[model samples]
Target: MAEKLPALAFGELTDVVRFLMEIDKLKSIQRRTKVLGTDRQENTAEHSWHFAVAVMALAPYAGDQVDIFKVLKMAVIHDIVEIDAGDVLVYDLVARQAIHSEEEAAAIRLFGMLPDAQGKEFHHLWHEYEAGESAEAQFALMIDRLMPVLMNLHNQGQSWVENGIRLEQVLSRNAFIADVYPALWDHLKNHLDKAHQSGWLK
Candidate 1:
């Protein structure tokens, strides 16, 4: 005698499915940073995955002891806002600030697509990461800023050169990395200097 399967929960399943379908747009939402070692531009989905990968590899090097899992969660969900708000370039300070309010609104709508409990959990992580106050948030934020710096260094300052960005602009935008994660910041600075001297970074 075999057990019979239960009837599907269509309403609950429908909500979750909708949320999954909505987030799929992240794959198509492109960022300014290109894929390292590749000529192709990176999308928001790839950026989120790479940020999680960076967190996994660099967790032990965090400036302060942190909840690694929370940091990972933060990295994964932080950019879900890009689905509605879109990716803002690091150098676009005015535009970046302009989108802050819209991003907060988008966070509510996108995460709200999930079930109530799940949506709140996601919004919390997204908000925490934006605040960058806690140790985990600080470390997660550090990676967000560092990854683009590394990409430009490897790509002969691809985006910087394309956009005519200067060294002061790059350093000014990334100063928080040094303030929070000094060691990683030092490593970035050394590569940045090499990038500048090599004429890759202006």
Candidate 2:
């Protein structure tokens, strides 16, 4: 049986605690990317943390004009909506389009778990990232694409192979990197070429 608990206090912090507990749901949201060299796939919680770290580590590579803080914020919250919508691979064209409404609904419910002020802020940040209209969002999107590409390459194109994703699809999904961070795009293209030459890509 589960352990019995003591009485709890209900106060100003209750909403905050509730919000945090609700987000624990993110851990169960599995992503398409795997931990390199492992057969197992990653969950959204791990993806968010790793992406936040990557934002910090790669911020220097982003243009001098971008805000690192905003970029980091985008990385961590971009997939929080996936807790409901689940993950849809970028190459899955139809599902990607279908999930937009699902994700928006999810974002409304998930972020609304918090107090109004915080929830509004969370939703705004998520919307900004999704829009990719600002420099921070653009950089965040680049790293988001680049990280999975790196994972796929290191895993010998595991997901790419499983999904039968093609080189043109990858290039199209990742082309934005060339405009924002050419060096990062060059690095990603190198790995992609290696994957192609190794016959890891079909």
Task: Compose the digit string of candidate 1's lDDT tens values, residues 40-150.
Answer: 889999999999999999987874569999999998899999988998888899999999999999999998988899989999989889988999998888898888887
Count of clashing residue pairs in every prediction? 0, 0
TM-score of each: 0.90, 0.93
- Residue 36 miss distance in model 1 (angstroms): 3.0
The number of residue pairs in model 2 that clash at the backbone is 0
**Candidate 2 local lDDT, 76-96, one digit each (tens):** 889989888999998898999
Top TM-score: which candidate number? 2
- What C-alpha lDDT values do all the predictions have? 0.87, 0.87
Model 1 clash number: 0
Cα RMSD for candidate 1?
A: 5.7
